[model samples]
Target: MPAIAMETYQDHFDRPLQERSSLEPAWLLEHRKQAMTRFTTLGIPTTRNEEWRFTPIGPIAEAPFAPAVSVAQSVDQTVVSHVGFADMECIRLTFVDGRFVEDLSCLRPLHAGVITGSLGQALAAHPELLEQHLLASDWWHAHPFANLSAAMSVDGAFVYVPDGVTMDVPIVLLNVATAPGARVANYPRSLLVLGRSAAASVVECYVGTSYGADLTCALTDIHLGPNAQMDHYLVQRQSPTSFHVGALGASISRDGVFSSLSVQIGAAIARNDIYAHMGGENVECTLNGFYLVDGNRLIDSHTMLDHAYPHCNSHQVYKGILSEHGRGVFNGKIMVRQDAQKTDAKQTNQVLLLSDDAKINTKPQLEIFADDVKCTHGATVGQLDSDALFYLRARGIPLEDAESLLVHAFAADVTDRIRIPIVRQQIDETLLARLPSPQH
Candidate 1:
């Protein structure tokens, strides 16, 4: 396929919604129309936009990415196992090219009253429920991609836990893109809701093979009721020549607890925009991120934590390791509302540049309106400590081995926050595999 002309951003992304809306509910069609309108109104953000100043998206804006709506092929078990955790006890839901593949999924028995399946199925079975939550968050209008997901995405994982329920097993939302001749694009949307006092853990994973440059636009929403608790993890391991843009919106009620660990170790040009809203008082939130890039790849992570209520606590730690001509960006903003007294928030962004050409642009911000809040943010960009490197080499470690050890140690602060053993092990294995590869 030839490259499309560089026209309006909407020209490159104008998907046909009318063709696929016959089976969908009327309300959903209206929702998609509204979302499409919103997306066109917002358009593609440019370098002039402060939030997108560092990440240049010309490849995504101008390239012709075909809508992969009807691919008949399905991946076998071998390909599935190669992308995610090897041995794990969990209820896994799989999607290929943004559509669910039930044959490749393992839907285990979950707790009573719990709902787990693709968003498209849930829309038919529980339309009212889906109406209440799908693309209904306050942050969906923040960027064009968020509304784009709502308008264009056909299927994704949906999990719902009722009040007082506790799910011991994990729920995995696995999405994969194929290496087609044409540069195809997929919009994957996920939603997870936990009722009052409910508890659950979710793993969101994205991966793809080498390609002519596939594009993936993923959006996720999380809503936690009062006293609810959740452990969340996001792992991105797409191919090196792919383009990925992901957006996540979360809201936690009073006394709710939400903890997430994000691992970004893939894609040639990737961007993540995450927002968390504290809805009530005494909420606990933690956001940790780790990214490793090499071979002229670029990864950008932007986060916004809104402390809207009083007595809330948030801790953010983001670390990046860039090599070769790789470039990375981190922009984390913590906002404490006027009534958010005693809001304890601390954020840190640190980077390790492995090559002279590697570059990082980090901005850690704290916008506090309350007088009684304790907020702090800091960012550091540097290379490995020469003294530490020398000491490791003196202890009989090879130069490459010493650097690898330090790199792992540098990323442990974020990876260790993941409580799931399988998730942690997968990350460790990926790190080891990347150590010997010339490209990451």
Candidate 2:
């Protein structure tokens, strides 16, 4: 008979540290130690938790997965060349099974004062910066997964831009996971810091190959200095049998501008959390997301924009397309503190269901303590319009083709907002090919 299975979460956390903390600097060692303790105390949030009421995580909590480590097998070069943004000219960092592949990366000829490379290397070369910015987000202690990532992450993407510098091209970081035999887990961490008056753009993509039980837990922290500007994009495409939990936290300074677009199209159970803080006056922030879920998949997005000072502005829009019993959840929150007078905020959530079985949960909220501010939020869930389908069918289009056209039209609202031409086109093509077939 097989041995009784142990509790996966406890078993994994109880294991000894993969790397010896004693050999590292005291600050990092203490940080890791405290993070682990906090993770254990918090445990995994259950369905009972208000924030996670809609998404169930039993499959993840029970998976017997070990922390991902470097592998001897090399990734095929062709595989790296064929992924998204391949045609664009940009510095690329490739990782296989959560470990950085130096031979597969291109980081040379970068503009002066711009740093782009691996987090592991950055930890060695720029310890003070890493120590200052790592796990420094206000939301860091609010989630167990964030603590777990901070405790176990070994490698990730790191980018730093100095004062008055601007990157002409976007920087891309790609993560690919392969699990041939057993269940595994990867902790991918990223840190982006911009000095005063700096400007840059970045893309972070996560793709997986193994359609088996696996987990990818990722965390990213971005800080923009005064008068800095930054644009960030995140894409996640895991296998149907994989689980993904990710977080993106940002801090914008006075007169700074920050914007983000997150797209999710894969994973059995995926949850993405985004938090932005306007820490200084006259800051501008925008957050947008799009997700396509199908085949019993569940995608959850939670975002919060905090106006901490006067004259800050924030805007958010999240949209989803669900089919075949797929489920999508969107929760957005905007908070204007007492001191945040002259704040402007707007939020909207929309979902399109292609199948009768498809489901969605959307909630947009705003909390304001300031007497002089403008805030608004709304949510909508709808299916393909029969009138539009009839109009197309009457125009000599086949039934299936007519339905596909309407579906594409419903999704165009979000895709059209994507700034990168290649990224937008790729997503449009993928969604077009996945349009639901007409029923008899």
Candidate 3:
């Protein structure tokens, strides 16, 4: 942590516990206290931190960012229409600056036994449920950012799908940040639970407007019961001057199916940490990610898939495109415990550099303790194929156009993995508009 940033943040963190903990119950207050203590002890991570070695976070630590407060007029209805996925038929819950805006949200005709709304509201309406799940475990205490988010998180999205219930359409959890200016921060926390035999799809989008040099640290916990199935997508499109760090922790039960797609195309320095655990037999997991960065931006993705039971399967693929002086990092690990016999897992990471200055650091690791398990991991980094560019240019394509064509082709594999047509098309267009100019 930078000295000036740390000194400034200490004041931000010194708010009286009573002032921040007034409304919550005793259990929650204690939870916040414990997390706050951990945050103080751990402080901000530096290059010395193994997980943060490749990604330097001095800019974020030095910035004087206080927690975001609610601004009713900051977000209007028009902003939603421009963010894509607006045409989809799904339940929409909107939040601005970490506070849920009930007026801007669209929630109607929800399915039977389904619960979706603000996390703070849910804590009041369904204390028992929130007590059973939110901040109930020590899983998040190990990370400083997650601990800070838990300690300072005021509001976010919450969803609960009862057993045997299947949602016909996806649920959109939209978080918008309209900062009055830079030097502000927002802590967004999400809890999604799917009961036994239930199925649903969820889309979590993080976007910012009129914000320069801001910060957002968000965390999400997804719990799936036995035989439950869930399709999760996390789309990050914050302002180019902002900083973002997000963590996703998931638990899968027996015979449960969980798949996640992560697309990152925004933020000056962005890092995403995803961890999925299979607790029961026959569970299946899939993790896919796509990232595009240029012009000195840095994007880092760290993922872990853990198998604790027998006969489970896991597959992961992450691809990246870096241009100009952009930088990227991909570190993925798959672990199979001794009890996890018959486990099958595979992990791959591929990176494309559009210029000589573009750089990437990739590491894929697999650790298997079970003799019967099969695991493999690999990573590849390379520049655009000159042969392919030449072929396209020979076919009457201009040099710039030919370069874009090859770049698009390199990205096609990841684009085809997206199941939502509108999102796919939107990403296609966004990638083209941001493609780096080919250097002569």
Candidate 4:
């Protein structure tokens, strides 16, 4: 069969700024104009681009129609109840169809200097913070989808932790796309301003209940103050027929620590981009991700860790499991600037393919401009160990059970890094459910 033409995929690019121009601020209006121009000139990404050469987006280009507007949906309490974290208490914020639902949320009274609310409400209540960190557009212009999201996103969450306050409970953001054919896109922009010595943890869940063609574009921005420590987790389990795109950027100050964990299991086509900058001395950042792809699904994860100051350390490890005709992509880059002496950065990407048709493309890169830095990267793509399978079978385990056990062990390596027990357990169950059954 012949391949589909890119131009026919109008739904991906037909969303012009004028369609929703009236909903944004004057500055945002002007910015959207510029962004639209850039998007029009550049158009959709092609395989010719070095960054996208391995992963073809023709399937996405040929997808039909625009995302659905406002559709009615109800959360299946049974399904929602199945997803829970029991290790620690949290302020649960829920959103259905990309719109905040207060009745479904649970917020506990917090200590001083912590503000959590819908982005729209926060804009009205705390305009100054919004003006400072809402959309720092100058930092990046390579991804046109990011610009498109900034222009069209309607509802999301906003969290701000004031100086000198420690939040013991994790602030959880649950975004659920319930309606089938719902074109719900949200830009959940969070600005974490931790005063010196403050600490907090956050969890973000992206889920879908119905199986329809949906589109989700989410953006999260985090800022860590000096001596602050934060752990951020992003869990995605949308419909298998949906399109998901996300971008996250973090700025770390002196003596700060930032830990990130990303889990991907749903969506027909999903892409996640993360960028972290160590702006202060003695800062440490850890980036970890795990993804599972089955059937014809595709999941892509890209990251960039920038070391700009002295005595900064970073570690990145991403692992994936592919089955059937599933495909996975992982691209990681580490940059050490000239002033970033005494920097230690390491990155690794590994993939395990279960079928002959399954495929994975992985790349790990290190760019060092400092002579006194220690930076290294490695990537590997392979199948499960036949020797290990034989050993399991020799121990009287069934072949299918052995395969499942090995696959789960490989994935558990990453899940164990998750400090939140509730989040870890939820991910474990979701992954097991998505994996191929032992009988298969």
Candidate 5:
């Protein structure tokens, strides 16, 4: 089908305007309408499309629309405390389903002129600022999910750091999807803008409380000005029976540095897409990711790095450990334009299979048009080294423990890049907790 009839959502969209937040701007209504129009034009993706050839998204496209569609907002702090990450000194914004929970959020004193709060709130206070950065590319759409997310997003995190300011405290946006008895679909959104000479660290986490088959669709947009630097991380930890699809896009300017890592270890089916546009000179970008899947689960990742300027550098490394019929996919593409001379880029993808049924499909591609640019790509798929396993067994180590140790060490290549100590430890423990049973 070329389009999903508007009749599917017209009634819901025509509801009483008074039901929405009073602070909501009039422009937002039009913004959502445009997004819906684009979504209908794009329709749902299918396996025929090269981008989603291996994904086989029939489960998503054929599933009936989930009801009670309102974002769940009644989750109390007690439940959130148990969902995992230990309490630490930082700025945090909590969301249940897609609803923002103000009481659960804690804020610290930020530098002068720095603004960090709810996106719904920012729309009223700084509409001009949001309009400048939020989806500024007119006459453009990055597939249907991006449009669907824009159409359905209600409240999410918003951050803006002015020039010459530095934020020391890490910023965390915790999203928890809760559905006890029914299946629900939610879309979460975030926008971050950093000015020249600004630096900060941020985290986007998606967690589910129940084992129900919930669906989460998320999108994040980031922009960095000249000389700006930022460290970003995306972590997903939902029930193994749920589904997740998320996308992130970033733009960096001259002398800017953008570092991001993805740690995905949840859901039965998950697809992550990342795109980076380096259009300024002397820019540095790093993309690192780690995924652990087991028990019939699947994880897929697709990344695109485009270098449109000279004197830029990009590095990427992704590793996955799969077991128990679990499957994984990694497709990374790097492009260097003709004008992008003096560019240096490297990409690698590695997978460790713990069982005969576990499998991975990896593709690392490099498209270079610049004669002076240096770009390389590689991918490897292998099981645990018998030499290493035998060495551990020779020391009287239990077979299962030896296997677990090797798996943990295999993950260090990507996990070691995490700068936050607490988050590092959290991922480390979670990795061990989810280790698969030995196939004796």
Candidate 6:
């Protein structure tokens, strides 16, 4: 494939980083320039790239790119109301068109040394931590989107939890795009560092107005110190005409526990890249994801799990449901390093298609350089069971209702793994509403 012309998209790419230079560090500026150079050399990924073989970026690259501009329009409360998660009381940080809205947010006072605020505020208040953790990690290789996010991100959230502080209440980061016919782009960056023995749960939600052609490029970096525990969930529900791309990098220390759940149900094109590194012994990690697509929508998930230390365990399971002309992609890779003895890793990917036009491509890969490791990977793609459908019909259940029940049942297997009640309920309701009627 030919390289995409940089002249066509240079205007959209240059404006955001230029306007935010006053706030960004000088070192970061140099890094961004280097990243932009790499982006220019690599251009947009195509079907030929091994990592992106099943997904295509031609449509996104062809679309005229535009930077999100400031607007005075208030966020639609109806859209906000649609974002609640059962009984969970949260500190809601709201962003409209890549800028923070202080008045619209509901932030709870912290009891200790933890700091949770806008990225701009953090840059001024906690420059030391930001200097150490902000885009300084080594996980930013070969990922064009991550590089773009670091170079052009204007606004995002920053979270810091001090040592021994446990936050029981989930912190909610809500990002919404309010303009119609505007090609909006956002880089919602989050830096979460859990000190030794600290614990917390976080929920990140990406939503947009009902009628907008938007784009969101988000990045989250989580660092877990020794004996720390953290649970994270990302729920993406953007406009059907929007595009969403995200990347998550997590590092776990000795005796740390990290769990992540991702649910994607919106956007015309969506892609997610998740990377987990077990850097210490006795660490454990779990990665789970579910995606539902309809119409001409496309969703892709690419994940990597690295066991760099000994006596660690990791598990990953991803499921997808496609209907109409929808398409889905899943790629999971697990690597056990040479010195990482006694490592246990498991991975699985499953898909269910409801129409002949629907398509799914799934790949699960495992690479082990350790002599004493247990690893497994499996992938499956198929449709609903005809015998089960006939059995339900024979039992006098309406076809549509039976189909809904079965679809729900299939998705429930993954949703049940969610540890948070409020988040679990929200996933259930969202899946129930977005799923197609079983009447077909």
Q: Count the backbone clashes (under 3 Å) in each candidate.
A: 0, 0, 0, 1, 0, 0
Question: 216, model 1: CA deviation in Å?
Answer: 0.4
Taking all chains together, the TM-score of candidate 1 against the true structure is 0.94
Clashing residue pairs, backbone N/CA/C < 3 A, model 3: none
Q: Candidate 1, residues 1-440: lDDT per residue as tens digits? A: 12233233345344454565667877878877787778767777778888889999888776556667655374667667896554678889989889999888888887888999999899889888989987468687868888877877879888999999999889888888885656778999999999999999999999985565888999899999999999989999999889999999899999999998899999989999889999999999999999998988999999999999999999999999988899999999999999999999999999988888888999999898999988889998988888998999999999887877888888887888888888888898888778432222
Model 6 collision count? 0
TM-score of each: 0.94, 0.94, 0.96, 0.89, 0.94, 0.94
Give me the runs in candidate 2 sitting further than 4 Å from their true place.
1-19, 72-74, 437-440
Judged by lDDT against the true structure, how good is candidate 3? 0.86
lDDT of each: 0.86, 0.83, 0.86, 0.77, 0.83, 0.82
Task: Name the top lDDT candidate.
Answer: 3
What is the Cα-based TM-score of model 3? 0.96
320-404 in candidate 6: lDDT tens per residue? 9999999999999999999999999999998988888999988899888999989999998887888998999999999888888
- Give lDDT tens digits, candidate 4, residues 164-245: 7788788888877764543444444444556677788889888877776677777677888899999999898888987787
Residue pairs clashing in model 4 are: 68-183
Q: Ten consecutive residues with minimal summed lDDT in candidate 2?
A: 1-10
Instruction: Quote the lDDT for 181 in model 4.
Output: 47
Q: Give candidate 4 regions above 4 Å deviation.
A: 1-25, 31-34, 63-68, 71-73, 76-79, 85-88, 135-137, 179-191, 437-440
Model 2 Cα shift for residue 315 (angstroms): 1.3
Name the lDDT of candidate 2: 0.83
**How far off is residue 164 in model 5, in Å?**
1.2
Query: Across residues 1-440, which tens digit of lDDT does each residue of candidate 5 receive?
Result: 32243455434444634565364666776777788778777777787878887776666665434523444555677665664443767888887777778777878888898988889888879999998898564322756777777777777789999998889888889988886455567778889999999999998999887788787888888989999999999999888888889988888989999999999999989999988889699999999999988988889999999899999999999999898889899999999999999999999999988889987888899898999988989999988889999999999999988987888889987998899988887888888788665464
State how far residue 136 of model 6 sits from its true place (Å). Answer: 3.1
Predicted candidate 3 versus true structure: per-residue lDDT over 1-440, tens digit per residue:
65676566556666756675677799888887787778778988888999889999889877668887778586788788878756777888898988888887888787787999999999889999988988545556678898888877888889999999999888889988876666788989999999999999998999988757878899899999999999999899998888999989999999999999999999999999999999899999999999998988999999999999999999998999988889999999898999999999999999987788888989898887899988889998887788887888889999877877777877778877877777778778887787666555
